[model samples]
Target chain A: MKADNAAIVRFENLTLGYNHHPAVHHLHGEVAPGTLLAIVGPNGAGKSTLLKGIAGELRPFQGTIHLHGVRKENIAYLTQQSTLDNTFPIVVQDFVAMGLWRHFGAFRRFDATAERRIAESLAAVGLTGLENRPIGQLSGGQLQRARFAHVMLQDSPLVLLDEPYSAIDANTVHDLAGLVRRWNTEGRTVISVLHDLEHVRSEYPETLLLAREVIARGPTEAVLTAENLKRARQLAEEQGELVGAPVCAADEDAEQAIHAHLGHKHG
Target chain B: MSLVDTLASVPVLSPFIEFAFMRRALAGCLALSLGATPIGVFLMLRRMSLAGDAISHAILPGAAIGYLLAGLSLPAMTIGGLVAGVAVALLAGGVARNSVIKEDASLATFYLISLSAGVLIISMRGSSVDLLHILFGSVLALDDTALLLLAAFASLSIVAIAAGLRLIVLECCDPAYLARISHLGAVAHYGFMALVVLNLIGGFHALGTLMAVGIMILPSAAARFWVQTIAPLILVAIALAFAGSVVGLLLSYYVDLPAGPAIVLTLGGLYLLSMIVGPLGPLVSRRRPRWHFTR
Candidate 1:
């Protein structure tokens, strides 16, 4: 919502969509570096679309996202659903080694240091012994751990995760949430789309509650109020059931959200 | 000569040792196996074997058109097939991306249309004898020009595959991530599709359009039953394809069978064998071992 010094990512009235029907409406925000932010929304409320915009997967139809200096090499994004073909014939170690691809590329020989780092990432994710096993043979939890290992190896300044904990056992979630914390501690800007509002309240420092637009954004305590959340859910449910429903005016909702956010600040 | 005497007299090596046509066929098969098998392995790896089949079908009309215009000319048929095959592939893919019809469904629709158009055109302009030649190929009648085209195309295929090796693997494993990191995603995708069409053209020259895809797909599928890594899988597929081609040629020579189907059947036999007995196949590995790991 506000820029401090040089913002890591700044979105200017961004509208992202498919086939001219906007999934994410006009919005403006600036994310400071090293901010541990959580994006919370009802299903189809454009949380993933916002992340996709930041990851450069989707283009904004009518706005700009300035990434100060970050490029593809400096960012790591994990999709909501794994895009990997599990039936592929590749060992876990080799898959994890892809995080180092920006440096060593796909062809270079991984030196001893690179090898050690790969082993370390796998060990950190509790997949050290399973490195030689085919990635397809890994169970869901094991594969998620492997995914985290890959993200760890990315060593990027910006890390984006979409629903990293869905369908995962609680123990695995706790383990992965710890890794997310570790990344923020290392001064990486970490933005995640999470559905577990309770978990976000306890862990994420900043929260953006979105339902096709910014419903509330700022400190977790100020944004996750009961009134704002109920309103957000009601807005989402109104449009969720309709097939090709008429869109509400985007700027009108933005005005209401701004007023509500201001009232929270003064209160 | 009687069938038994014919088989006995010719033996294994004499097919090539005695006949100029047989020698030429062997050389053609060698070039084809070296180039096409790797592309087939990639097709299998991407799980686009069906797409490969569709493109093979899509090229039929192009080849038939060439036959109508030039009367069994190699360069004419090859260029026509390449143009038509790539066009259909791109069209289907574009429709899938721009609309809601999904890629496989779009490919199926376009290939059927293409096949019917080709069959109708050939029937209108050419005789059934010409149709059979285009459909089943004239491997024994491949001229020096055809032989040179095969060798040159095969060399080009190997070098192209090597150049795109890393991008291809990266695109296969995680393409969205690759796009996030670099702009090579389109190059990898279009380049791989181009290779698929190129190899199908080669396969159509050796086998008919109907069985061309069979040769490309079956050997690779069988190789997967045996090998777990990409490199070994491709190598085994190449070896299996070459062996199947040679043996099929010999079997056709002695038994008076159609060579294209014979080659495909030989590859099918190897696929079945691998499915039963290869180390990673169902019969060999999928059963319960009645044992557990102990620390």
Candidate 2:
């Protein structure tokens, strides 16, 4: 119920699930503006689900996900690279131009200024000459860079990226990571789902480690402790194939304990 | 004879100019090609080409019911087909949304049931000839009413697609992105389905429910072998569909063939040829490296 002006996202008693089975259960947290946060967890820990909830793609099964002061239009989401169909018949420039959808909407012409911005974005990603090329023709590294250009065009204050580095080369990863850092420097709130602990340690200042629940949420160094990491893995194993509606009394007790713990820490 | 007279006297153009039925068939086919082929391109792009076939089958029972009620009245049959096609589309979508069964599988189930139901209904009341007409269509027998219906549907499809081009493309290529920005993702999806039903109804009148999807999907599939972008793919598909209609009509006139099958067969031939010769086609572009035995 408390709305903080500094927070870009606030998750209150949030439980996100499919078919009533919670993938992200009883999450209580607030993401302050301009914080570059990394959400790291084991597979099926609801990292992507959390991002989808924030992006409004999935509604919370139990609670509210508030976007503080920003409208949904001000949030830019880059889905996991694997979900995109590369063989789709879209050119790189046109694909990148889709990021400007919020600005011009469906029918407006992509006038000269828009074209220039698209060119600038492509140049920033070092994909200048390849604008006219079909996206399917690009190499994995090049495709990742092209997607970065798209994110640049989006230019939203709240940016959420899911598995942006998966299946990408180290060089592309480094380059794209630089773009993430640049966006952070420009005071954009960025939350990324990353697997590389080393990268998260080096680049991201804040981290949230999840295993179907928040195990730790704080500074990168403190949250990624060996004990916390081990606990997250152990929790994931215990949860096992039992992802569903929160009908179990044991889950409710665990959720109440977590909420109490979070309340005590914040208070 | 003069050169103009000689050219005009050629059997290909002469049949279309001489026979009113040929001209009516030509107009009907052209209208369907322009409207439905573009929709087919989107379906192929979305990997829902089979859904187009399934939806066409779903229309059969509706048309049968319409036949039973109005005895071949164009309006009743068209409305019935539209209702059936849209209902199946919405139902399949709903099932996919709610259950573990995916959209394609759900559509397959519904369309099979519909096809069987349509066959049963037709057998119960109508003669074998009437059933054949419904299944295979009567393109050469297209009257003024059917042509008017086709023309109207074609116009509506063109306008609707043109107006919603960006939304439709975004919905097909990157639905998550569309959903993030606006609720137009759902709008585009449902709107596109409505267009599919409308175009399929038009196509059913000309090519029959069984073969209608052929005119829609084959040209788009063949065009995919050639074009790498959506705009050109749509253009190529429409052009291919139009050519198929004209060539198939001519063949039917000359060889005494069934018009619907002839048109679809022509498109199928084009698809096969494109598979071999077009750029990025299997024959032209070697996806696998050649193996050699070395000493």
Candidate 3:
């Protein structure tokens, strides 16, 4: 991949793994500015691992991950799975305001300005009236929107989401995509790992296919072809046969393979 | 005695004006609550409750060593305890990061090792009564120096928690982002753990190790049932701690009971009340509609 100012992120020969065990090897790619890139792959395909590497949660073993022509910072990441202490006592407004914490000094209080930003962010994510409600009181979709509201409050140019719409309501998924598209139009770069191929095909223009490595990377139409789909299915098959192993890929859906494999792309 | 006289004669209130030791004890109890409650709130939210418990217990060995090295002086013991506490937290964090062992398990292992080491050190150097005073506390015979130490700890904990409030909350909610942008997560964890250690050491004279953990955790747990935001949670926790202190002290003084248990029991009552009256939980506010007859 050629380096350019227009490029927001680049992974050169990136290899992600734990200790000596390699999960993905010799991956090379670049995510362009103002574009939404969807990462699609089978179970154990290292799709999330690739996103983790890009987000700086997981460091690549042998390759270089360069963001904005420099070292990676000013990047916002939302994890695929979060066990939020739902037992946690925090209001939606308070939760969203947390995104502004990095800008404040350790002792600094959230002034009226920060509070205003939190309100705007909540309103942006369609959580206007629910600001004072405790996070525990929110349904799954509402909770995810609240999380998106938090990310919106972060006000970063680069946003990375790991399955942002998973386990969310159809309305919430639509609202979230609208927000992402709005951000995309404003020139913010978005990279999300999506399980739904239909979402990638219809909602996203760019996609990267992976199975422990880069099976393909490019526009959604090119990368998410029948061959790549077969490769992803094969990877899923291999994953099911192996037990007691750490499969970090699309492992969350292997148990419901029957329902998962039926293509939702056309629907 | 009339009901009013009976109430007045209760130890919690009786100690207030009658004797200096009792007054100091009451003050100590209140201060301990203020010191430990906020720390507990953040610790629980961070899912580091066991880490707080571990660090609290782990302070015993250091306090014991401090006693052996510098006798009964507060400063020496405090410095010793702080050092040991920091060491244990760092070791646990390091182990958690490097090894496959989860953070809670690592903390548990650290706590057991440090606590046992402290007991052995105390046994080798001092009498059983002194050890008991250090381990289980002797709230009745607290001196001025003990009061000063407790006050200092309470002040430090309040300040530290106040300063780190936003960062601590943010870190607990979203550590991945913090790690990407700054050192807030790691720093907050260590800083908060240090404060917890200080509070444990400070309360050592009043409640001892076993009972101090209760003071630190119970009030916060009770407070959590009442509020939805971090700021409010801390405020409610502080208030609950104060109430517990006052009631517990009064009850203990008049009824001839230990201050620690009294405070813990009061906190437990608050928790039960919160469970019943809390607005968020299903148990407290079942969704079923209620129809009323003519009132």
Candidate 4:
């Protein structure tokens, strides 16, 4: 993949991993500004890891990821809902207000403007009257909506979502997808890891398909081909043995498998 | 006697008003409740309730080493316990981060080692009565210095908790989000750990290492049954802990029970009662839904 000067994100031979074993290896790509890109891949395809790298939660093992025209602090990341503790004794209002931390900071008081922004975010996500309700009492869909409300309040130029539609209702998926579209229309770059390919094809214009390595990237219709998906599944299945297996021979096998997959793609 | 006179002359209020030791004990207990119970609420919320118990035991060896070095000096023992407690906490966190051993397992391993080491050290040079004092505490025998230490801990705890309230809440509720946005996640985590260590040191003085965690965890667990929001949960836990201290001190005076154990037992009883009758209790709020079929 070639880097574009007009692109917002340029991944230059980036490799990210834990314990010296790579999850994403030698990936090169550029994401244009204000583009709605869906990262579609099988399990363990480094989809979440890629998002984590961009979010600065995980540093790249090799190479660099350049963010053009935006600071790292300006990127808003919506983690998987499972990563949050629902049983915590936090009300929805306080939880959503956390998005404003970048503005008010850890000790700053929430003034009238902050309160109005919080209310607007909540109302945008259709959670206007549920401010005082404890998050523990919210249903899964409602919790996801609340999280969307938090991300909305962030008001960043870059938004990253990891499987935002998983386990959520269709209505919520529709509402959140609309919000994603709105964010893009407002000139914010939106990248999401999605499982619903039909929704991706219908809603997203750009797609990046991965199975430990980039399978294809470009227009959704061109990248998410049937053959490319089959190859991704094959690569994922081959790499499955490395997941949580003892870090001796399986690591070598994973590297070999990724190399072979990439070789076959290029050859 | 008139009703007012009878109420004023109740045995519960007499020991507290008449005896200086009883008054000191009351003050110590209240101070501990103010400082430690809030830390316990955070522990329970983070599912680190057992970690609190582990850290409490981890303080024993440090305090024992202090006793060995300074011969029962409060400052020496406090400094020793704080160092040991924070060291174990940092060690466990480091091991969990660097290795495959999870946080709970690492904590359990360290606490066990610390507890065994402490017991051995104490048994080597100290008498049985000294051992009893270390294990069960001397709450009713609190001196002016001990009272001062407890008051200082209480003040520091309140200020620290107030200063880091938002960051702590954000860290507990959604750590990943906090990590993505700012460095406050680590700040909240380590800052809260320091408070936990400070409170544990105070609790050890008031209730002994064994029962210290009880004062921290029981009221928080009990409060979870009653409240749905963080602020109210903390407030109710503090109230419950305070009530337990007063009632337990009175019970100890009237019935001739050990003060530390009596206080823990009182808190335990409150937890049990809350489990039955509190808002989210099984009896109060049925978890299962009643079914109906329609034609």
Better of 2 and 3 by TM-score: 2
Runs in model 3 lying further than 4 Å from the true structure: A1-5, A69-71, A105-113, A231-267, B1-12, B69-71, B100-105, B113-116, B269-295
Lowest-scoring 10 consecutive residues by lDDT in candidate 3 chain B? B286-295
TM for every model, in the order presented, reads 0.87, 0.89, 0.84, 0.89
Score residue B213 of candidate 1 by CA lDDT.
84
Candidate 3 C-alpha lDDT tens digits along B1-295: 8775776586445557667877787778778878887888887787777887787777788887888987766677667777887788788889998999988789889888988998898888889987777777766677888888888889988887777777777678766666676766778877777787888777777877666777777778777767767888888888888887777777777677877677678877877887777774457556534334455
- Which of the two, 1 or 4, has more TM-score? 4
Query: Every model's DockQ, to 2 decimals?
Result: 0.48, 0.64, 0.41, 0.67
Pairs with backbone N, CA or C atoms under 3 Å apart (clashes), candidate 3: A45-A212, B11-B250, B11-B253, B11-B254, B12-B249, B12-B250, B61-B118
- What is candidate 2's fraction of native contacts? 0.76
Model 1 residue runs over 4 Å out of place are: A1-5, A19-21, A105-113, A225-228, A234-267, B1-10, B123-127, B282-285, B289-295
TM-score, cand. 3 vs. native: 0.84
Q: What is the lDDT of candidate 1?
A: 0.85
Residues B234-271, candidate 4: write the lDDT tens digits: 99999999999999998998999999999999999999
Docking class for model 2 is: medium
Error of 1 at B122 (Å): 3.9
CAPRI rating of model 4: medium
TM-score (0 to 1) of chain B for each candidate: 0.93, 0.94, 0.87, 0.94
lDDT of 3 by residue, A133-237 (tens): 888878989999988887777667788899998889899999999999988887778889889999899989998887776778888999888988898778657
Top model by lDDT, which number?
2
lDDT of 4 by residue, A185-234 (tens): 98889999999999999999999998888999999999999999999998
lDDT for position B148 in model 3:
83
